[model samples]
Target: MKSLVSSEIVEPYAQALMSVAKTHNLADRFGDEVRALVSALEGSADLSQFLANPFIKVADKKAVLQRIVGDESHPFLRNFLMLLVDKGRILFIEGIGKQYLALLRELNQTVLAEVVSAVELNDAQKESVKQRVQNITGARSVDLQTTIDPDLIGGVIIKVGSQIIDASLRGQLRRIGVRLAA
Candidate 1:
């Protein structure tokens, strides 16, 4: 129920931010700023708690945001941050930023692929995985996020959305074991 309420608050704010980004042709810039803001919020429990504190004055919150965003931030985003402060929605900024990025990826026809392999992939291997993901998802671009998992023994596992492509050695062995058991 709390998650449902949070999403209800998050989605409209994210959509509103996306609408502004689209209107000003600043989607990429806004996405970058939002990502940075979300990173800050996540990295600093103090900052997150400060923003969420009801006793904190709105002016102080805005001032902190200004310092964090710097003076050169676009007026629209500056105003957006101020609006969040005023509405007491600043606490949800991280969720809003994440949702906005998801919307941006959708707009750009990009897919995020989480790839786990037994070893670090070289550029060539990374590109191959990305190209394969593109072919599978029909996305214009693929945002390949890679991780190393030695337990896989060899090969890679590609996960996109709810689909999982397990090309790893351990997965193959598990499948073979299942077949033998049957």
Candidate 2:
């Protein structure tokens, strides 16, 4: 969790790996490999012990990791694991995996736009809404991820990055509530 909190430190490494993965047409594979590796590290007590056992050599740890994850593991994962072994951040493998996946998702032409509303959108409505997001973000295309929250009352909230377009009746009610409470 500490490593996750230090995400700013990992972004550049993740981005560089993502760039190489994209260049090799292996982004999806690399992401999957990282996920699998993290899962293994989390699920196996033996692996964790072996990784952090100070008495064990780093070369031994690398060999064990290779055997477990296999030669088929993505180059990014291999390089990342080796780096952790070198720098003694093997404990943060999960953090690196997560950061890499996040970077990969962002680098792909995919942007997660959460459109919250009082009701679900029909197919046509969803497509049109996603198109609008793409237009605003200047992304190649927008893959619209939808959420229906009845509490929103009326109107829509469009969120991309740190920006949000909230035009909801519930939001207005909240403003009214705040004003009255004040």
Model 2 lDDT at residue 91: 61
Per candidate, the number of residue pairs that clash is 0, 0
Model 1 agreement with the true structure over 14-116: per-residue lDDT tens digits: 9999999999899989978887888898889999999999999999999999999998888899999999999999988889988998998899998989999
TM-score against native, each model = 0.83, 0.53
- Model 2, clash count? 0
Runs in model 1 with CA error above 4 Å? 118-122, 147-153
Off by over 4 Å in 2: 1-5, 109-182
What's model 2's TM-score?
A: 0.53
What lDDT score belongs to each candidate, Candidate 1 first? 0.93, 0.78
Please provide, for model 2 over 1-182, each residue's C-alpha lDDT reduced to its tens digit, 9 standing for 90 to 100.
76565675566667767778888899889977887877787788888888878788989988988887898887666877788788876765666677786676677766778799899888987898788888888887665557889888787888987989787898888889999999
